[model samples]
Target: MFRKLIYIVISALLLFSCGGNGDGGKTKLVFKVGKVAGQSGYLAQIVEEFENENPGVDVVLEILPSITDQQHQFYITSLEGGSSDFDVFALDVIWVPEFALAGWLESLEGKFTDEQLANFLPGPLKADTYNGELYAVPWYVDGGVLYYREDLLQKYNVKPPDTFAGLKQAARKIMKGEDNSKLAGFIWQGKQYEGLVCSALEFIEGNCAGILDDGGNPVINSERAIEALAFMKQLIDDGIAPEYVTTTDEEATRHSFGNGNVIFMRNWPYAYNIFNTEGSKVKDKVAVKTMPHFEGCESASTLGGWQLGINKFSKHKDWAWKFIEFMSRYETQKKMALNVGLKPSRKDVYSDEDLVKQQPFMAELLNTLLQAVPRPVSPYYPQISLVLQAKFSEVLSGSSSAEQALNEAQTRLTEIINRRK
Candidate 1:
């Protein structure tokens, strides 16, 4: 009995010394990667596939919040605290400059060869670079598009709108003719979040005014920008867009459109696949087009997507890079694009004959993706975006006029940029 007791005690000591069961019989290194919801299954399968070939590595996934703003905050806190909990993470395109500048992400300049870097789409690839250093790999591409009810347009005898003015007229005409109380003429995310910044950028870009000048100075108070914000406010005030939109996020917009409550919606490409899925009420009645523009300007979409990055504090950066490289390959990209409707980062993936056949919209999206405009690339991007979101929300809620809100935003952004200097 004494001998058995001694053996048990030794075993317990050994287990405690080695940090519990994880180090007891470990033959593999376990690492974690994180992303937002809805891609858990697909991402897990991809990691499992990588594990099969690696044999001595385990890739675990950490699911993040669906709200982009919350997700951004989560990353900021995690990475800034030097937490090694997430060795790899998916980053929104606009976060590249901020995270890289803060030294939270690993510089990937020599990790990928010139030929490999050439495979990604130019806009997304450019977004991964900060001060000439590559810090992330483009995982996918996203840009806003307008989704309208084809049946309703035909029923109302109105053509697809080519300009914002035309879109408003069409929406008003359709809503008045239908006389349905539950149906809203148009819908979009108006919440004070990252999505609101993206939506606001689209409006500003479409109006031929952007958030920054060519030299990266704040231009949020331009005449065209105020006009764009006014248009957004007018839409809500005129009853063409619902008042509850001020509380809406991406999922809310999707749910509203999927339930056939919205006549038109402006959202990312992912919404296209969702709305046409089997259970959607708007299936077969939805058609997508690029966002409408003002009279002189061409249509514009705020470039969006996610990137794969290695944490600067991670011990398993080599393995993390291996996982990133694996997912960035043409075959894996094609699989994800075809299976889950994720837009591929690789330029050639969109031109794949098989993919285009399965998703006819790819052919149309190529031009849109090519011309997509990136948001202001700055180390102070987070602050700048917050100012824009707050000011835009003020305009939408009628708490401030477009000119006043934009002027406030401009003042805040200038202070932020100058402080960084």
Candidate 2:
């Protein structure tokens, strides 16, 4: 009798542990999602809120490496291997086309309503779509903004520049008036990496036109493109920009600007809060605006941000969509914006009275974001970017002239585009 009673108790415990719902007789669903460590805090909060609102589900947050490249590689390897471990993926803005073309992501066209689709900014929405099909939903948006030293501008009696020529003039004047050897006129991402591609796109687009025509043909070897790249080389050649800029990435430029050593910087919105926070040398002395353009051209910013997509191999795609929808709502976006300095992808959120009052810079940021342009939306984008990056870096390092580099880039890109076809 004692052995029988023990067996019965063990059996009861096993039954209880098997996820049985006592009241409704339905087992709870467990959904797994992944994000980098930088976004994990707000994501955890969203997950907790989601779990509270839906008592029948559990969200498992799989934290990935903070480094963007490492995280990207991990996702590519896992997804390519047909792993179903993660139901949803937080993807880089540029990865949508690659993943969608590879069929690693589910087409999200019908998952979103027309009204919902209209809320997102056009540039970000453009990034989430591939070949006329939606593969992801924009979670946040980013664009390059010009950050300047307000106090220095005032001291030098200079106004903010609207044109690239004016910016160069202002930077030179400030550097001279300050008379500090430690000061540099401007800094930006010039390193020979993916960042160089983004920087080059801004310059190429701002000077005249983007690298590709509307028909998706390679037009990177145009005179306007040569002039654009020449301007980049001229900055380094003319001593207006430091020689070390060739090695500088976003964080390096940020540190130089934050330490009050740079008069101007081109960086994303993420740098705004850090520049104004306590302990920064330029705290309260920094101002941001749209990037400068050529005299006759309108300013163009490179669109960048992150989006969420459901993995094609996931079994819990329905619940995965639910989590994505929850996180993409207006309230959720506003909350994340206010708490974590994330730029919202929605046009409506930019006009929120309370958010505007709290984040005054969002007013300028919204203007910049509206004018932002996405990089080429193609699965061959990585190879294309590599070609441009290599050629542009050559120009900056003085190993190749602007025209020579762009011509080479054009040839390489055509080969890549045609080979993929």
Candidate 3:
């Protein structure tokens, strides 16, 4: 309650401060927009363009924290308190269901025609909808992919693996041939966080299983899930992946791979440009492919990215939506893609001539993006993920067997879902 009250006060002040005059001393309608910080500043540039195009509406961009958990908690506090300090904001893909269910996001059902929505990648579009209502619009997208040292693979005469078993075999061969005691076979985001849940989902679904079935009941303790978890455990125990992976996240794995210490890595699309940058050790030697799958299962990359939505409490719903519409435009998304290497949520942007020429990898990723899978879609997902993280950490850290950890997770998830009912 105290936190909520404090957020309310902060929001009220923000509202008053942002609702001020334009730079030219002309009165204009101001709409505040909040999004995670550390972007390429293309957003600020786009905001300037929007102001020039709209004339009479000023948009203020509030840069939020980069940490996902901190951003989630900040939104919960402000939205739960009915604060309209920001008229529009960005939401992580997984937050759409929870935010919409809480009545925090405005319904955009009829705002976009079916054809416009169709232009976006199916995975992100599905994630932005809740209970058949469009609650947000995809701005940019991300999906996990496998990064490997292409030169090393060629030198070792190893084909990029399409299945987990093949990946293990190829990794072992490369490790043996390289003869670098400092090098590890593979690395991934295994720390106990949302990234861990995404990594675990890829492994589980690669084995043709899921955390929840079609009816939304927990199915995380199935034989396939146990097999997947056991495979991950074996990666650590057998020294195929280092024990330190259990403590690392996306950036850590990227750095380890960029430093030329790992044979393979599972990470999102954003790391591609960074790896090719001048100072990176693996520059020009890296290539990406769809994440490896189990023997009979198809490859799966976890669907991730941010969406733009209007605050239900905003006084400027129409204007907030205009800003969203602008941001989702092909030109805006293209600029973002070319400038920062952010994967475009719009399918057409991937085929843009300049984008294909500059970032050909993105064009190649279209097929993989189409097959990407989302984590369970539920308002209770945050709580469910928390349970999975703890249990998964236990399994990965060797404190519990895969079966024991998953069974405990299943029990805890059941309790969480049932209590919500």
Candidate 4:
């Protein structure tokens, strides 16, 4: 009995010495990533899985509020302060340049070798790279798309609209019906947020040299840009869309849609799950497609979504990279598509048999993502985004004519660039 007891005691001591109760244990790396606020439920599930796979890491995830612009602003202040508390940040595609230029991110060199680069969707990966150096990895991709009420369009005996004008006409008939005045012809993000920039891109693709030209100069006040904003004004003035849309952002517009109060809306695929979930009024009846364009305008879709990054101050860089590699693998990626509605970055994942069964829209969604254009990638991008949002809101609200708004915005953009220079 004594010999047995001694053996047990020795085993206990050895185990205790190894790690018990956090005594001289393995290095504990506290990593942080951003999540959309109120969406912690969804992201927490992913984080829990990650923590389980990486037993040596203790992760702390922070979910900022819905406004992505504010989250980026938080990054600017927090990272600029040199706080090493966060080892990873959820980055937006355009913020790659700012973070990289500020030297706030790790080299990522030798971490994600060229072979692994083949896993990412080309557009998103390109968005995260700058001057031949990659600073982040594409987390998920998003593209602008139109959501329409299938039943209402069917009632009108009309096919899905092929052009913007056709869409306007379809919305008018639906709203005029006795049971549908409460329904808007069109609803979208017009509030002064990053979404405004996203929502407006469908109107002016291949024009105005984009928000920032190839050299990162603001092209907002160009003739083409004025025409684009004017189209928005025309929509409201002509009664195709209600005037109050000026105050609507993502949540407001989404709320209106969820209540079955809008004939059409433009939003990212993230809302697909929310709109089709059990309680939504339009469940199983809403149809989604790429944002339609003006008759002569080129079809355009704005790109937005999260990017994965490694913190420069992390001591366990190699281990953290391994986790990233695992998360980005083809098997893991398809699982993410099934688990969360996140569109994948890999080409093959789009065609996975399970994904096709889950979302017949996957093929169409992938096509849009492949062709979508990334917003300007630059250290001064946040400023340019603000300029576009302000002018766009003013023009849509009738407070400023499209011409005047663009003219003023152009001057401000030029001044900002000159100052930076």
The candidate that wins on lDDT is: 3
Which is the winner by lDDT between candidate 3 and candidate 4? Answer: 3
1-421 per-residue lDDT for model 2 (tens digits)? 9999999999999999764444463223344344432566877897789888877677777776656677788889988899887787788888899999889999999888898798999998998889899999998898988999989999989999999899999999988887899899988899999888888888889988778888888999999989999998999898899999899998899988888889989988888888887788888899999999997998989998889899999888888888889889999999888888889999999989889988898889999999999999878888888888889999999999999999998998889888856
Off by over 4 Å in 3: 1-40
User: For model 1, what is the alpha-carbon lDDT of residue 110?
Assistant: 89
lDDT of each: 0.86, 0.86, 0.88, 0.77
Q: Who wins the TM-score comparison?
A: 3
Q: TM-score for every candidate vs. truth?
A: 0.90, 0.92, 0.93, 0.88
lDDT for 38 (candidate 1): 67
Better of 2 and 4 by TM-score: 2
For model 3, the run of ten residues with the poorest summed lDDT = 27-36
lDDT of 4 by residue, 227-326 (tens): 7778778989987787888888887888898898888998888877888889889898798887777666656778888887877766667766766666
TM-score of 4: 0.88
Looking at candidate 1, what is the lDDT of residue 371?
73
Note the clash tally of each candidate.
0, 0, 0, 0
Ten contiguous residues with the weakest lDDT in model 2: 25-34
